[model samples]
Target: MNQQPVEGFSKLSKQRKIDWLIKEYLSDDRSYEQILQQYWNGDAILQKLHEEFSENTISNFYMPYGIAPNFLIDGKLLALPMAVEESSVVAAASKAAKFWIDKGGFKTTIINTKKLGHTHFIINVEPHKLQHFFNFKLKKRLFEATEEITKNMRNRGGGILNIRLIDKTADLENYFQLKASFDTVDSMGANFINSCLEQFGKTLTEEVAKDETFTPEEKDSLQIVMNILSNFTPDCIVRAEVSCKIEDLKDDSGISNEEFATKFKRAVTIAEIEPFRATTHNKGIMNGVDAVVIATGNDFRATEACAHAYAAKDGKYTSLTHCTIDGGVFRFWIDLPISVGVVGGLTNLHPLVKFSLALLGKPSAQELMSILAVSGLAQNFAAIRSLVTTGIQKGHMKMHLLNILNQLGATEEEKNHFVTYFKDKTVTHHEVISQFNSLRAQ
Candidate 1:
């Protein structure tokens, strides 16, 4: 039976917390306690930093940090850092990168980099009057109020792009918005944008209270519901593509490059039109995207939420990747709505995250967006090619071979023998176990 919940869990020392956890939940197992201690960092300062990253701290959870090399993006060769536990992701990305390098490699264009936020409020007022007051009376004051906060951003060539007073009374009673856009430059700008928005919220309340146009009731009825930034950056888009002569593609699955192009295009089209397939299709793309995002210490959850939302922005969930073949040339691309930073949050703190940024040659936010979009495109191509040709299971199961060997407690000699033995053989959990048992008995 589970023990009752304890209060002030956060207040407990790390050791005490571990003690309580083991006693209450782990049956006081010293082995489980040792597992946690073994994962702790050797450096006290670094461990303290990790502890402070979240509340109710525990030992660090580790993920394999793998490299996807030979990525020639926009003519520069880079080996991307991908952090994921999934067995085949890094291998697939590397294979795709090498395949495209001989072709044109990955090319990208930054369409826009505008991010937005809203100060949501409720106000019972005449719509036309409210709009009129915003136009002549309150607009200048809003900008003036945030000048100090935005001064540094403006000096850096990025600041408030625009602000508008939106009317949404048709959807809900007394609901409206102060929608504003920003250019945050090289950082993700979540904090900067939110700070500006909070100021907007305060300025709105103060201005409304003091303005003669609002009247007493209008002033009192105005309620600032929230001041927050939106992760849905629809306008922030980057396009990454790989194009090559159809004949340049190498297919060993008994299919011509021409046939491969047609089938691959068809697969992509199905994802674009069908919701069910699109979900899994985009998930595969994110298998590459989220890995890079996490490795660089960016927020994969925010990145994922924005991407999935962008996929369905047309009112239906669909693929973020596309494919085309025209005039003897095959092209694959993804217009990914991804926003990432290279100079803030964990970028400045985590050691491995700093290494990832350095390994990518310290990309700006826009450049990082291009890299991320290209990663997704590369992964989608690899997946589609497999689905249309040899099948996803063959390579995936082969990658699972190592995990299986570990699970069956195979010795080093047995592992080496089985790895060679399975070079041309199909790998399944049962088959591995059976083969290992047979080898051991012999």
Candidate 2:
């Protein structure tokens, strides 16, 4: 529980300062709210974002991860905000972000704000009578249901903006589709839309009672199969931009910054239009976002689904994040559908979430969103950094050596020796044993 900052970090930039402080000290600090307030000029941003939105319907999740200090992304300091659970995500992001920070912080811009609408229902219509059920009442029932769903949303800043009916069948088939656009404020509106569908399904069944064309047996035979939540959560949208300087892309690999950026851009290009490549491309972004997701206890599954879906939402598989070098600066951007929250559900129940939120001092959804954007960019850099300079195995192996040594109950001297040996790129059990023996002899 040392309050002292990481040694030599004073020479780091402001973004580095925040990164080191959060990574090392936050685990011990009782609250990050104080740190964010003391450093980032208070939680004013959080206040503003929440002031414009309602928490009653939406929840926001926030995770503060360390973005290595001294980052110069497009010549800007990036306070990378990551929402993910796995370790090394923030570290990877920070490493990548730092690579760009020296040139200029990752130049990122958001694209649009879209939302998903979910509906759950229970129907009571005869199986055979279903053929005669297509009427104006069905359309009316949907409108009425959408109106109800949009009622509170409109008042609070969101409403049913649009509705679409997709037909899964054109002929005498039982499957039908009813989709509505409800502007859910801030968070994913799965709960809200489902409630609306429950009512609509019941009303539709009741309306069938008045149909003279259907006999009593027909009406009795009708029943609702799956009046549950709909998966057509194709509503949210996101976009970002980041750029790095050519001079700052340097590493020990000796690849000139420009050359490296070119190679990295080529890799990114290959990732585009290739599902095999795009999956890894998007995985890097998720590394950052998922960290915050686990930190805040949101539904990581749903968030991930929407993200991948968004990547190919246009019917073509492609990278959600884009990287390039423009005007002598390396640029990175990611557009993803991230439906997460900072309040509600387990954001309060989970112990780590509350602790992380307290450490963050309560950030606004937009601020949190911005931070997530940076994390995505940073993660992209990390992958490219590994490919362009040091192979991915080098640093990872060194880190893993420490864990392995710890697991083996090696003494501090023995562990340090193993770490040094591994860093030298000589990773063999024999070498590890030799070092351990030498340490014991000493």
Best by lDDT: 1
Cα RMSD, model 1: 1.2
Best by TM-score: 1
Clashes of 2: 60
Runs off by more than 4 Å, candidate 1: none
Q: Give per-residue CA lDDT, model 1, range 1-442, as digits (tens).
A: 5699799998999999999999998888879988998889999999999999999888999899999999999999999999999989999999999889988799999999999899999999998998998898777888999999899889988999999999999999999999999999988899999999999999988988988877899899999999999999999999999988888887778998889889999999999999999999999999999999999989899889999999999899999988888898888889988778887799999999999999999999899999999888888888888899988988999999999999888889999999999999988889999999999999
After the best TM-score superposition of candidate 1, give how far the Cα of residue 299 lies from its true spot, in angstroms.
0.9
lDDT of 1 at 333: 87
For candidate 1, what is the TM-score? 0.98
lDDT of 2: 0.60
Give the Å shift of residue 325 in candidate 2: 4.1
Worst 10 residues of 1 by lDDT: 249-258
